[model samples]
Target: MAAPDELFCWEGAWGLPSVSSDCLTVLAYAQFAGAPLKLRKISNPWRSPSGSLPALRTNQNETLSRPADIIIHLRKQKFNADYDLSAREGADSLAFISLLEERLKPALIYNSWVDSKNYVEVTRRWYAEHLPFPLNFLLPGRMQRQQLETLRLLRGEESLEGGEELEKELYREASDCMNLLSQRLGARKFFFRDSPSSLDAYVFAYLAPLLKAKLPNGKLQQHLKSLENLSSFCSNILLLYFPHDARESSGGQKSSSPPQPEGGDYDHVPNKRRKQLMSVLVALGAMLSYAVLTGILSIQHMQKEALEAPPPDRQTLDPLDEDEEGDG
Candidate 1:
């Protein structure tokens, strides 16, 4: 038997299997397809083979970073969840997925990273606490910037001056998308019938975080809760395929580990040691850079202040010299 492909994804928090939507998407798709995957839940992306979350390391030793590419690879390996879908259903799935990316994604990003209250109180705090020390200081801010850029690109704007107007627009579009999805799902156990498919995976991933996370400004979450079907849909997926995650999210302790990969626990010791070494080296480097930068800025600021200061009073010194002459 071949070793299961290894999936490197963000660590679960706030009760989801992973905090990242992209990671959740791939994880759900893999589960739906029955792909044998060794899950490595991590806070630091640098530990992953591709230096990114949601990376898949195949049996052939190839690394795939994108969720779409990982799904395609799984399908090629004969683990396709979408294989049972009819042509029309497949088309509908594609259309709905596209709609999700355009309409729902920006608001998700905004709620997670751009919305000040949620970002500060929830999103940033979660990452900062979970991530390794120096990375805790860096990656959350970097991730926020990337999400903001993604929002700008999605809106086809040079920049997004996020305010009430922008938030209103994003929330409105997302709410409408959720309503449409609720109408389409309409009590169906899964999106495409009894069995889950790629669309179910995408929908579950996109909605689960919003449903599960405790955002400070929860306008979209409020709207989602009002649409009971959509809320139930996310809950059903959690209870069905991800019971462990559901339990953890609902405040229960994790009683057991997810299934392990082919190797024995001892086999990973060397790799674990290596990752620790790398983390230490990276932390040291980051600290060194910060120190050097701080010192340089301090020196420059002092130089500027010195140049701006008035010359010392020579007249006062002359008075002291005359007093010495008079005493002589």
Candidate 2:
């Protein structure tokens, strides 16, 4: 396989050179396509035209930023790894990709950022390891806010200030998308059956980290574990293609060993997160209104006092009110 000119992306974590899902998506395609990609890790997203990672500069000096665009460019250049699907199958693939992109992406953001436990333990730590100190501090938070904003905009909502309901809805939507993918894959060797498609790369990219990471919330992890075929599908892919990482993860074992939870010791934490978001927002608005009203009333009272009272020296001092009882 001829080497790629260069691929620019965020550095990896968990003993990887490129740990990001998007970065891995691109790498996985290149692998399946027999494209030899040389990775160039970048700390700053500004290095790319879209201010994002996983940008590729091809042998012909064409710069592509997005995964779909990169794959299209590769196909056009006759390095064709893209599935030559029938019109119906192609449409189906496109729909599935959109589902993963729009719905699944936000769920990932929730796992990494909104989930307090995952953010502190896994996501933040991973990003911090790859970034400079201050940037490590700022970037994770900035990413969280940006993803939250994106979710808000996608849902056609105004603010994420009281977004618990939205967050819950997003989680459900993501889970549904996952289940749909699982059903579609449905014991097939690959989504396209024996011939891997670009969607397979995306599947591996998104699931790899979540499945492996020892996160605190464990909801996302648990949800993934529930999908038996999906788990096997991911494991099988790594064992077949990425034998090194797969073998290392399995302690030098050639085959993929799906990690098992011991003896039904899983925590079924009741999602106590309530649906009182609207109430909370309304309460806050009321408090703000009360504060404004109080301020206005206070100003009016001050004005009345000023009008009713004479200047101190000119006023007759009431004996009952005089503190010192001076010369009574």
Candidate 3:
């Protein structure tokens, strides 16, 4: 028997199995196709062989990072979610997925990364809390930068300046896309009426995050919730395919405490004490380095001070010895 492929992906949060839309797409597709995989849920992307999340390490030793490439590779292994899709259905799938990318993706990026409130409170805080030490200090900001760049590219602009005008345009297109999807999915259990397909995976990935996340600024989320069918669609998929995560999400909501980091699987506070120690050490080292670099505290200066200090009172020691002889 061949060894199962290993999938490294972002840890789940917000009751969704993986916070990343791309990772959710791949995961849902794999589940729909019945592909057996060893899942390695991780908060740190650097742990993945490809140095990114949603990476696949095949039994053949090939590592794939992009979700599209990973899906293509899975199809080659006869794990195809779209195998049952009719020719017209397949064409429709491509069209709708394209529509989502062109219309909805920019909005998702904006709300998650470019929107100041959501980025600071929900998105950045989630990753920063879940990510292991040192990286926790750096990667969230870097990821935001990358997401912003991606959003700019999607908008076909050399640079993006967030404003009320830009927000209105993005939300308008996103709402239009959601309405279209809801109309197409009117009363069906799945996009194709019965069986799940890649289209289902794609739509679910995009909508689930927006629906489930507790964003401070949730204009898109409110619109999605108003579309009853689309909201049910995401909920149904979560219950059917990802029951464990669904349970976790429900449990988290009922509790008074804040949601724990990634469900005790990925950096789940097992190394929290160690990370705290390392964080303190790193902070101290940084402070010491800064002091030395700025000439505030110098090793050579301390050494010179020690060397120039007056010798201890040899006469004082001799007086104690002389007093002892007199007593004798």
Candidate 4:
């Protein structure tokens, strides 16, 4: 029997294992190692000892939090899965995974949270599904604010700014990163030749969400698609390891993607009507908020006008001053 009773993780998106790359990495590690385990979906990480999802709690009363740590633990203690990796390969995998975490993670946050439409329509709703009622109402906002603040600090900006220009820049950087990975992969099945090292799981965890998500700022996804070899690698791994999520392009599926859970289709996060309604609501709210901000400025301008004296005209000007102007 597998030691872990439940692998806690964020919920799936479009039938993928998880929307969270961290969760995906841990889960993929288990799957690739052929470890027996159960998945536990969650909306928030408040209950976790590490205060994060993707926690691995074992039946032996051991708890592991953070995907990287969980994967390492699995390899060393649970699966002994890295026997194929030589000292050199293991060192390379370690360095590559670190690079992926540092570069790709912020871009994921930027695309999902900084993009208004995606946050309102997709990310918010998806998160809301997992939390209790009142927390559901507030936590998403708090999380979004955190993401925005992080972006501002990253960009060295004083105020929140979200638009296509920012997305364009972020996605360009992301595209370059993907292109480099694609070149690294070339014609190989995984990062280190045919065998999937720990690096592949980490990469797939990050890429799967981007590839499957239908976010408003889909430039990230578009960049992934343009790298055909990278797309194939993800598809092949999804088919081999996460067959339930491989419905879209996998050949000869025994069945379609995991049947939509009770209550709604995950792709739309309930139904078409609700998603449309959310879209309209987001658009209206954005316009209203913009108007309010500008309206405050306009109101302040009018108040200034009311307080300040009018510009001096000929009636208010003295003859001496007029002569002074003429002389000058």
Predicted structure with the largest lDDT when compared to the true one:
3
| Ranked candidates (TM-score, high to low) | 3, 1, 4, 2
* Model 1 Cα lDDT, one tens digit per residue, 234-313: 88888889989787655543332234343343343435777789889999999999998989867766776787642356
lDDT for 23 in candidate 2 is 85
- The per-prediction tally of clashing pairs is 1, 1, 0, 0
Estimate the overall C-alpha local distance difference test score of candidate 4: 0.76
Off by over 4 Å in 2: 1-3, 14-17, 41-51, 251-328
Q: 1-328, model 4: which lDDT tens digit per residue?
A: 4454668887766758777787888888888787777777776777654567878887876788867677767766658456688899889887877767566766788878877777876798778876765688888898899888887776675455556677777677777778889988888898886677778888888898888776765768888988999988987888888887666434322344356443344464445687588779999999999998989867766866786754455337777788899999
Number of residue pairs clashing in candidate 3, backbone atoms closer than 3 angstroms, sequence gap of 3 or more or interchain: 0
Q: What C-alpha lDDT do the candidate models reach, one value each?
A: 0.88, 0.73, 0.91, 0.76
Error of 2 at 146 (Å): 2.0
Give the residue spans of candidate 4 off by over 4 A.
Answer: 1-5, 44-50, 150-166, 248-328
lDDT of 3 by residue, 1-328 (tens): 8999999999999999999999999999999999999999999999999999899999999999988899999999999999988899999999999999999999999999989989988898899889986898899999998998888888886468658888899999999999999999989999995889999999999999999998878889999999999999999999999999999989977872355543433445446798789879989999998888898446656765787743366447877999999999
Q: Estimate each model's TM-score.
A: 0.77, 0.69, 0.82, 0.70
lDDT of 2 by residue, 108-203 (tens): 877877777778767876676557545776887898788777767776756666567766777788888889989999988888857777878888
Give the 10-residue window scoring lowest on summed lDDT in candidate 3: 256-265
User: Model 1 — TM-score against the truth?
Assistant: 0.77
Runs of candidate 3 exceeding 4 Å displacement: 257-328
- Write out the backbone clash pairs for model 1: 15-249
Could you arrange the candidates by lDDT from highest to lowest?
A: 3, 1, 4, 2
